[model samples]
Target: MSVYTQLTNDQFATFCQSFGVSFVRAIPITQGIKNSNWFIQTTDDVDGAYSYVLTLFEERPPADIEKMAVILNQLDGKLPVAAPLSVIESNSVQTDDDDKRYVIHYEDKAITLVPCLAGSHPEQTTQAMCHDIGAALAMLHETLQALQPAEQYGVPLYPWADVRDREMQFMPGDEAKLMSDIWRSYTELPLTTLPNGLCHLDMFADNTLWNLQKGEEHLTGLLDFTEVSVEHYVMDIAITINDFCTTWGMAEQGESVNFDRSKMAAFLQGYESKRALGLDEKRALPVMLAKAAVIFWLLRLNVIHYNRTEGRTGDNIMVKNPDLMKRLAAYHWAHVEKSQNTVFVLSGTTSDNQIIGVFSSITQAEQAREKLSNSSEFAIKEYTLDQLS
Candidate 1:
């Protein structure tokens, strides 16, 4: 609920006129954390009705917003993302630009408008819904392949280092130490080999709107592209799985967060339905989970530390409990390096065959699988159990 800049109806009407969209009424959208948003109900010259989300980009740099517009432009027709609308030309007819500011100045802040995709965020995220979002994300990642990765398209890692250097005020000492440990181990992961590309790093349920149906799930609207960036796809996967699949009631701020393993499997299956996850990706996922946890932990902490007076008046701030992320980070870090893998030997042509035995490590599992790969009509595979259930 961050609306740092306010606009009057007359001001909004003038702004809408530039885009050849008439302003009917405006309602402030206060669900977002980073930027100020408003649902503008508009009427064209012909009395045609439409709605758009007007966003004043805060926190992020102007250049990042430019690249974000480019990404949204590329994904306009391919996915359910709410892309920004261009301002009508001086003639008030056609509007086109290559790399100009689709973003305009409002109170010296960069702002843009996008069509409001219709759908409500699910009250309770179903396994089927998780599956739908997983596939949608993969499709989004696939379509985003066309865009070149740029510096501003990613959240820089150096900030983590800076965050570490800052003196702790409210954070528990042991929790802070655990976070440092995870970040240290995260840097040692095989980051170079993992699939890296443009990712919607933040895919929590609220960011997505769904077409809800009995025994069916459909993704209708994907919002808040501000957090999209260039990063390892597995990291994105980890972030989504943690947010969507995990559901324990918020007892306090962050006390009851728990990951559901069945939903995790279902989500991975759905993701693989569009794009396959390789063994390298699988192996790196645990640490990537830790990385996702740390990133969000630091992000929330940074926000709370800086914007202390965010929601003191009208609306309450949706402060995501950093402790929950901290807890998950420590959990993943503990399991990531554990020596717990199982080797499987298959009969016939199917992968659902027989597990030979549980090996202590992936290396040992590989050795056992290799010994039987040459056996008469048998397939071999290694499955790492990076403890998440």
Candidate 2:
């Protein structure tokens, strides 16, 4: 991510020696917010100039870093993962005795060197690219099915409660309520029935690399597995769709964000080509999309909070706008209400109360409630098809 720990070129050159490469240059990459990254250039006798990405883990523990390295290694040939280069065993003599196979310790921080992937991050996403990414993501999920359990790798579940207590509490009343509503909607879904596996939670276009050829863009690489964890497949899909299928800066036109349905369809088509989604996952998608947006909104807000309180400031620190994500979350909820695909069940408060009527639209359910006796209180409960199951 961002350049938090500054390193001199001489320091970089010294570090690169362990990998048996002559360091040419180390340029700070100032795009992300989690770790410190550098675009390193190295010279070899056979390959004059080759590029690699040098990453310095700013916050992760050694075990976390090691797990990431192992995961990347597992996915290396199967996908275009940026697998870290193993430290030359002979070079261990030059460094410390507590040597890792792929990772090195420098300045008490975990560091890794991965070959720079070819192609550039797509400036704009296309349907074809969406399809490719979706298919690739699905394939990635299937490939990791045989891997050990999430806990075995020390991968933690999504911190829904943590975000609610830490970030949402400090948010404005309206925004906090929106978050709570969306979270409740998500929690009510049949989450256990949804497919689960390793998921790249952050699959934004910028995290992927693409190459343009003959007017069509093809996915060349998928970058950044730092946020990868064991999560619902639908959750991963929702996160990806929120990014690839969303058009930013449309607030001036009217809506805060616009969802390109055609692109979303193409992406799902590609995903289904590799692995089909259960009907439950499809039904849960709308709410999950809103939930995904809320998570990112809170994440960005958290970043801003730390940057201000922790006093992390510099040209290398890149902070994304949280308001955009908040607006997107609102738009998703509006979309859900307007679509009216969810079922509404109306019931009375009496002890002998039974399900009176199930309506497709909330308006219809409200009308039915109005016609009923006002003496017995009524409540409209929303449910997705999966929830009924």
Leading candidate by lDDT: 2
Q: How close is candidate 2 to the true structure, as a TM-score?
A: 0.82
lDDT of the candidates, in the order given:
0.72, 0.80
**Which lDDT value does model 2 have at 169?**
65
lDDT of 1 by residue, 170-256 (tens): 557887777777777778878788888888888988899888877766888888877777888998999998789777466664377
Give each prediction's root-mean-square deviation over alpha carbons. 6.1, 10.3
Over the stretch 1-389, how does candidate 2's per-residue lDDT look in tens digits? 68999889888987787766679888788887888998887764234445788989887765677787777877889888888877887734555423457778876788888888888877678888888988999998888776777656536765667867898767789999899999999999998899888888999988998887746788888888877788899999999989998977644665456677667867887788899878688778888889999999988987888789999998889998888889889988886766565788888877876788987655346546755668249888877765554
Model 2 residue pairs with clashes: none
Against the true structure, candidate 1 has what lDDT? Answer: 0.72
